[model samples]
Target chain A: MRIAVIQFPGTNCEHETLVAVRDAGMDGEIFRWNRPEQELSEFDGYIVPGGFSYQDRLRAGVIASKEPVMATLKEEAAEGKPVIGICNGFQILVESGMLPGSGEIDLALAQNVMVKGGRIVRRGYYCGWTTLRHESLPRRSCGSFLLDGGALLQMPIAHAEGNLVTAKEGLIQELADEDQVIFRYCNSSGTAVDEFPVNVNGSTENIAGICNPEGNVLGMMPHPERAIFSWQLPPPGRRPPGPGPGRMVFESMRRFIEVSR
Target chain B: MRINLRIWLKIPDAEAATVKNTLVRRMGFEGVIDDVRRERLYSIEADVGNPWRLVKHIVRELVNENKEECLVSIDELDLDDGYVPVKVGLHIEDGEAISAKNRLVRRLGLSAVKRVERSNIWKLYIRSDEREAVAEEIARKLLINPNKDSYEILRARARAVGMRQ
Candidate 1:
């Protein structure tokens, strides 16, 4: 199986994601944004890796979403090809109106909230390890197959505007009902919570990742690729003797493709 | 023709007050000065011949699609006049506005002042005769952040006949 890692001008996570894909035993290739749409469509699966695309100008992922490649990516996703967007890639997916399968976008990853003294203000940038748990759903996708319900996975999150919000009420419930919500911020025991420190960016319902209604396109803020190596984990006790939690993400995708064939 | 554009957030007065107070308190200002307004937004300026098509494209492509309403105004200018007035505004919208204001109020002391709004304005200076096409291309392809804001073009008047300054 071959996976295409889409690279935008400011994307920095492509190399790492490519490494993770190759480690999972799938052929991985880097596809620049400027490449022709026909060439990009050749890949069986795609990953829009994270980075400060377009300098995070006009909101993170806003400018990149309008690029020519996204038009083709959107089309590929519509045909049920697996498309995973990590961090900035996730932002681009939402900005491009691909995730949640909302047809129209009414949500955004707003500025982070920082509580100082007693007042809440916008936080600039944050980077650290976070725990995520899978949300049980009947519709299976390669991106979410391995994550058992309530299983905890350690990952890193680095961003400023990571707070997920929607202007409309009940949107969170709508996503949940659709089985689009795939991951939630949780404690070590895998209990989902909305309180801060545990839920770093204050996402609604502690959502860490989500897929579209069709279950093919996934967008998540955490850096799963960065956690593929055991040493990448924080603290000695949390580290395992083998590959880290991130391997499951890629492995699941590869497994899904192999099984489907 | 040269066109000046003003963009601002359509925020409620009550909410704007909270933002102004927070800026003054957090940034260590001696209260907001008379001319400066507070809000997180952007401004852009480009010189083009016809301002209509450019502003229309900007509104369609660059402004926010959500209910976070934004206004873009083209200041009235006489092509013969050399000076143009430019303004821009940025404001937090929907739930964010209230959340930001509440957070600021909680952290900083409350203030008696009622209203504060945020936006950005752009001043475009054009000397060329081919304004419409150039401006449209610039607005559609070059301007930034169309998904989070909105825009408009104010009709130009003939320097208001003979007005008393």
Candidate 2:
């Protein structure tokens, strides 16, 4: 499968995403988003990694969302081609009005409240590595909001504005109805439990990932590329391999390509 | 590679996490590994693009918007003999409302106030230096004509935290 990773002005993770795609047993290519008019249809799918594209001007992903390439991205997303965006890329996706939650994300932009009901306002919340486990349904949080909702997967979340915010109907709920939420921020057991530190970013309903209406487009904040191997484990303790959510996403995309072939 | 800015804040854990998350998620760095327990160490891998420029832009945004999170480096903070917990707060007012004027800090009886850009919020670069002296300087300078309720709250907090001047 030919995969195109979008490289914008401020994107910092394009190479990592590139490595991720190549590691997934697929042909990974870096494509410049500035060259939006280029024939991107040749690639099987596109991955928009994270970064302050255009310095996150006028709000995160706002400028990049209006860039020349996004016009083509919107068209492709409409066509049901698989597209994945991580972190700021997800912000761009939402800012461009591609995600379900209106256009802007009402994210909680403070420190992580481990055990939400705390007296002292803590400082660092997005640090440390949590064991990723698949959720029955994907949920949004301050960590990852790029994965599809309603799917269970374990992926490392890293972000502050990752708090999933939606339009009037509660975008997360609407995505849940379509089984589009593909990731969740849950306890080690994969149960839909909410507590301090467990949910990490105070995402609504512990939502960590979500998908487009067609389920073909996946966007989440967690870096699945960072967790491809067991050696990457920062003392996984006794957790098993079922919750390696990154592979699930990669596998799913690979399968989509395989089936297409 | 990432630059380190050492500032003091109310909370450590949550603020560190939030900043790191912003670095990795919104800013889209490979990752940010903590250095030690010093609340400043961050790691970001090289990207296809120039990350230094990106980091500079992201850091400026964070410092301007996230006043409660960012600070000037440990080295810079050490220069202030008073050991003030200095968190550089840059307050944005209208167009070119503020500029980096070190002499003004001295003239207003203030040690130093790092000012940059016409951002929305006051980017207070608070460092863990001489808290008392810096707070006093702030009181004398910026707090001279204060916002009633807000200043009252700040005064109370500063007094409670043993702010000197």
Best by DockQ: 1
List ranges where model 2 is wrong by over 4 Å.
A101-115, A118-125, A131-153, A236-245, B1-165
Give me the displacement of residue B55 in model 2, in angstroms.
33
**Model 2, range A214-240, lDDT digits (tens) per residue?**
566666767777666544556656556
DockQ for the candidate 1 complex?
0.05
Tens-digit lDDT track of model 1 for A59-155 = 6886677777888998888877889999999898987888767756666786665443444544557888899988855335557777776668899
Q: Which ten residues in a row have the lowest lDDT in candidate 2 chain A?
A: A136-145
Q: Give me the displacement of residue A142 in model 1, in angstroms.
A: 3.0
The TM-score values for the models, in the order shown, are 0.68, 0.55
Q: Which stretches of candidate 1 lie over 4 Å from their true place?
A: A114-122, A236-240, B1-116, B122-165
Cα error, residue B129 of model 1, in Å, equals: 15
* TM-score attained by model 1: 0.68
Candidate 2, B134-161: lDDT as tens digits: 4454433332111110111121122111
* Local distance difference test scores for all models: 0.66, 0.51
Q: RMSD (Cα, Å) of candidate 2?
A: 16.6
User: How far off is residue B119 in model 2, in Å?
Assistant: 8.7
